[model samples]
Target: MIPALFDRRLIARRRRRAVAAAVPGSDFLVEHVAADLADRLAAVTRRFGTAAAIGGPTDALARTVTASGRAERVIRADVFAAGPAGDHPVDVVIDDERLPFADGSLDLAVSGLALQWVDDLPGALVQIRRALRPDGLFVATFVGGDSLTELRAALLAAESERKGGASPRVAPFVDVRDLGGLMQRAGFALPVTDVDRVTLRYATPFHLMRDLQAMGASNPLRERARGLTPPSLLARAAEIYAETAADPDGRVRASLTLVSLSGWVPHESQQKPLKPGSARTRLADALGAVEHKGE
Candidate 1:
């Protein structure tokens, strides 16, 4: 097993706290992303009989899928237990890495705005692939490497000026370019990956911080600094953010890059790459151009 990069226990605790204290309509980002994933899933040609939604504050994706009639049933799984009966009730609560389903049982698996915090992302992807049946689809979205660049820059500058050094303040995110490789490593066929960048304007850095906390997205790196961030440093960071990232309207911009990844389990019917040196016609012939001979 790989060493844990994140403190999963801490993640679960923070997520539970966020759920308990969450106000109605406070999860607009999560809801929007989940609904988008469901809409994409609905557009696929294949109809899934049994699907699973891996993580969310609530079963938002599951509810969307159920309503669209894309999946006959969707089992919701998360590290935190279900709080109350929402639009979509969770059917199971389990760690993101530990999926409690039989191999090759599910027709589709989807997750949104989660999996970025998992300790072993590659391992988790493998588990999800194993749970999927032949030609089963996997669609997921998570924060990408470019997310929160402005805030990260501000924090680093503040910490450097105030403390003369800095510790890990934000969790490292996966790169979109690497997603296709990860899918191939996990034995998925015809992997596809794309990115959607969403920039949100905030009144101040404090508001951005609060939103992150409410989403349970505060840094969970195992090697993160344990001491409280100095107020002076935070104020300086806020000032820096306003000066550098603020718009004409005076609202600071914070970027969130949502990377969507999708792949299907290997099936004999799926398209395969043609072998090299197998083409009967030359490119020159197709383009109606004469081939040049080298002396």
Candidate 2:
């Protein structure tokens, strides 16, 4: 049997807590990701009548898409209900693994940074594809494998030194190379993937950890160390991080590599790959070079 990668119940509870915390400016990454998705959507000349922002921690995706004028209506879906005060409300509650959208219900579907925590990413992508109409677009951005590299290294080194063994502290992320194949496997046409690395400077590692908690991005791995993390281990990790990854100004660098993905549901009207040997012009002729005979 395939082991569960993440604890969904824990993720939901943490997200709710994060909303309740109402930390100001904690949604910066989500906002950035949402704006990127909107910009990409705006690049497409077509307008979407219905769009769903799935599993977003905040309503940034919905708001950005609406502001971009790419979607006539944007529905925000999340695992949590409306926040108590000073927080965005979700229009629909959904599990990313089991999207409730009916087939062909959406002209556009987007997500921002939330899919990284999903246990079954390929299944989620399939559901998103199935929810879109023919030729409908899907755009999403999530943290790639290169994200949090410094933190992961520091944590591992500290754990190994202090405890003589290291456990799974940071959750695993998907590599950028594998995403395009996964999109094709999920039956999306014209699949495309790209990466944008955003680096944030923190005064100290603790501040970065606090931001992660506020973002509801703390470890949700099923094999995560149970009980509280030891304070000394964290201290050592911070020291190691400062020693290894600090900038010239003494602030630490934390990287968030956002992997942007775009795909479309299959449609006959869309561009298709030419059949083998169908081209009229030879490669050498197109390049104005003499062709060489194969031995």
Please report the candidate that would top lDDT against the real structure.
Answer: 2
Candidate 1: tens digits of C-alpha lDDT, residues 224-292:
888887798889999999999999999999998999999999999899999999999999999999999
The alpha-carbon lDDT assigned to residue 292 of candidate 2 equals 87
Tens-digit lDDT track of model 2 for 1-295: 5568999999989989988887999999888887787678768998888999888778888888888888889889988787657476888888777899999899999898888988788988999999999989999998886899999999999999998999998888998999999999999999999999899999999999999999899999989889999999999999999999999999999988899999999999999989999999999999999988999
Question: How large is the C-alpha RMSD of every model relative to the true structure?
Answer: 2.1, 1.4
What's the residue-level lDDT of 49 in candidate 2? 88
Give the distance in Å from residue 249's predicted Cα in candidate 2 to where it truly belongs.
1.9
Q: Model 1 compared with the native: what TM-score? A: 0.92
For model 2, the local distance difference test gives: 0.90
Candidate 2 similarity to native, TM-score: 0.96
